[model samples]
Target: MNIDFEINIYHEDYHNAGSASSEIKKYLTQLGLNPKFIRKIVISSYEAEMNIVIHSLGGKLKLDIIGNHIILTSIDKGPGIRDIKMALTEGFSTASKKVREMGFGAGMGLPNMKKNSDKFEIKSSPKGTIVRLSWVIE
Candidate 1:
């Protein structure tokens, strides 16, 4: 069976920062997913959600459970990343000072997301950005 879930994220929505991941965590738990796999998915989802809040105008996060793999896709609307390579680097962020003051922009979001996923891909342009992450269950 295949399952899919989607959540909308608004820019700078600190109030709902981790809600997407939290809800997904509950869903995975109810499905009896392995703890380690669920942890990775939750961590990556939180990072993606934060990225949308910190960077884009808004976005939607889609999670799909197909067979033994979980797929996550985040698509956001404008102001896109100027440098995809740099954005993936640790300690490199374009978040404003105000965002930094809130202790949310350490530039670790993308790196952490990639690190937690078995497979990761990112694409960006002047229009928007899209991030895809997938993990397999063993």
Candidate 2:
């Protein structure tokens, strides 16, 4: 079966930052996706979802399940990262003080997402940013 869906995410919407990932988890569970794959997928999805809330002006979290591949893509609008390399570093972050106070922004989001996915790709510009994570079911 193939599944595709998207959740719109707003800027600084901490209250709903995790909703997209949570919904994805429900679908994966209902589909009986492997537990090991679910864990990584959820992790990457959560991180990507959170990044949109914490950084971009607005964005959407998109999920696509095609055959044996599960992919999650976060596409955000405006104010892209100044330094992709630094952003991918384990301890680097540009999140605001309020976000840090909210117990996020410890700077592990990108690295964690990358580590948990079978394939990861990112593209950014002043106009927007996109992070794509893919996992395969064995």
Candidate 3:
């Protein structure tokens, strides 16, 4: 089965950042995915969502669930990441002071997403950024 969802990206909104992931989790649970797989998907989704909110000007997330595989695609209209290598490093952050004040600028988002997802791809340009993440159920 294939499932898809669209999520809005709102800047600096922690309260709404994880909403997409939450919906994804609910659907995965309903589909009887393993707890570990579900957890990983949730974490990765949350991280990607936050990246959209913090880094991008604005964008949307598309989650695709196909049988035993889960794929998450995050598309944003903000400035693309100039240094993908540095951005993936642990403890590296570019979040603004206002975002940091919310206690979300520890810089673990990309690292955590990479750690949890089986496959990760990032495409970025001066115009925007697109992140794709996937994992197997088994």
Candidate 4:
């Protein structure tokens, strides 16, 4: 079966922080995905979602399920990361002081997403950023 869905994310919208990821988790659970795999997907999705909310001007979270693999894409139009390498580093963040004081932006988003996914790719330019994540069903 092939499944595809998309969710819109708005910048600095803390009111709906984890909603997209939570919905994805529910869908995956209903699809009978492996528990561990579902957990990883949830984490990855949450991170991606939060990134859009905190940094980007706006973006979309796209999810595609094909056969034994699940694909996640976060496409955002923002200032973009000047240094992708540094952005992926743990304990590195560009969030504002307000965002930090809220107990978010510990710099763990990208790293954790990469760690939990089987495949990860990121591209950024002055115009925007795109993050693609893939995980294989076990």
Measured by lDDT, the strongest candidate is 4
lDDT of 4: 0.94
Superposed model 2: Cα runs more than 4 Å off = none
lDDT order of candidates, top first: 4, 1, 2, 3
Clashing pairs in 4: none
Model 2 per-residue lDDT tens digits across residues 1-138: 698999999998888778899999999999987888898999998999889988889999999989889889999996898999999999898988988998899999999999999999999998999999898875
Please give the lDDT score for candidate 3: 0.86
Return the lDDT, model 4, position 107. Answer: 99
Off by over 4 Å in 1: none
Better of 2 and 3 by lDDT: 2
**Candidate 2 or 3, higher TM-score?**
2
Candidate 1 lDDT over 26-99, as tens digits, reads 99999998898889889899999999988899998999989988899999997889988998899998988999
Candidate 2, residue 89: Cα displacement in angstroms equals 0.4
Worst 10 residues of 3 by lDDT: 9-18
Task: Judge candidate 1 at residue 74 and give its lDDT.
Answer: 93
lDDT tens readout by residue for model 3, 1-138: 777888887876767878888888888899887888789989988888888888788898898878877789999996899899999999999988888998888989989989999999998998998889988776
lDDT of 3 at 75: 93
lDDT of 1: 0.91
